[model samples]
Target: MELLLVEDDERVSRFVRRGLEAEGYSVTAAQDGVAGLSRARAESYDVLILDVMLPGLSGRDVCRQLRKAEVSTPILMLTALDHTDDKVECLRGGADDYLTKPFDFEELLARLEALARRGRGFSSEPPAVLEVGNVRIDRQSMRVLLDGEPVELTAKEYQLLDLLLSSPGRVFSRTRILNKVWGYDSDPLTNVVDVYIRRLRGKMRWDRDTGWIRTIRSYGYRLDPTI
Candidate 1:
């Protein structure tokens, strides 16, 4: 995922950039709201994280301006304000979500993932079931089926398959897979992704060379639904 982080505090910006980079997100940081606004207008990102307190312009104004300009990229506001009115203001300013200072990293990650999945803000629509070939997954129920038969999958396996299904025919690099499935703490050198891919194939009754899952020599894997 590509992200734009607008923050003034050096420490906070550094910490967020490092953490997101570790998770396979390409991030660009801006020190003030004006620079952030410029970058945001100039480039596209999967998401934007804005600090409420910023130099030159305030985060609320940035969000409001982006919305006014019809930039639909999801925005997550970070602030020390914890009051209900503060959160309402952030939302009213067009932020998709709000996170308070000193929050748990896990929560931040979860909210970002949720926002990305939700797409373009707090959408009210539910995700449609994803299917490729004979494999299908119901996002609402977290159910997987192979050839119309229910297939029980481990949480990790389910997540891996879901990622592939999310974008059929799009190759997912190993680093990207590791960060998305196993997280940043997983050893970069570990072959666990390979092992799990094999396991997922076996469970789905896919032969090594004749499956929808294709290994992209030395790169990673892709789900070729057309197969």
Candidate 2:
């Protein structure tokens, strides 16, 4: 599933993005309402998660504008406001659903799944296979193949590779990678991400100079853009 998350809180964004990714949802995030609105307009997603309190424009305003523009994507609003009036206001402004602050991750997941179902009339899923260059993964089987040959990968390695494959050529910072592949609660100083990257590279037979996985010095990694 592809999701647009509009949130200004780094901690909250990191938390939700990681949790959803771990469950195999692809996420694109915007830190403020302006960027969020732009992304919503320019791209397509299975669902959108917008925080009520945002910089530049509020989530309600964003929702209203999207409706006015006929975007029609299912929207689930997030707000610290728990009152009936607040919930009603969100629905009135065109939100499909509403979640109160400090929500249970499970509840959020359920709500997202519900919205997806409501939109598609059934459960939506990621693509059956994701391929970039010679590497590909079967979303259902969680199996990877390189050049028609099966390759073995640990769970974490598979996740790291999946992340890289999801956005070919897009640079992912070490911190973002760590938070996505690992949990947001992981130790920030750990070298675990580097270790996993090396493991994935070796198993995939990554070429140091021209492999799909390229390391950005002092930054992080990305799949080869030209591939």
In order, what lDDT does every prediction score?
0.88, 0.87
Candidate 2 Cα outliers beyond 4 Å, as residue runs: 1-78, 97-123, 225-227
What is candidate 2's lDDT per residue for 1-227, written digit by digit as tens? Answer: 89999999999999999878866689999999999999999999999999999999999999999999999999999988999999999999999999998997767977998898887776366678998777779978999998889999888998898888887766777766776787663465788888888888788877767767788887678788454
Show where candidate 1 strays beyond 4 Å: 22-24, 67-72, 113-128, 138-160, 167-201, 205-227
What range of 10 consecutive residues in model 2 has the weakest lDDT sum? 179-188
Clashes of each: 0, 0
TM-score of every candidate: 0.62, 0.60
What would the TM-score be for candidate 1 when compared with the true structure? 0.62
Relative to the unseen true structure, what is the C-alpha lDDT of residue 126 in candidate 2, on a scale of 0 to 100? 61
Residues 1-227 of candidate 1: C-alpha lDDT, one tens digit per residue: 88999999999989999877765578999999999999999999989999999999999999999999999999999998899999999999899999999887667877888888777555556467987788889988889998899999999999999999877867777867887888764475799999999999999888778777899887789887754
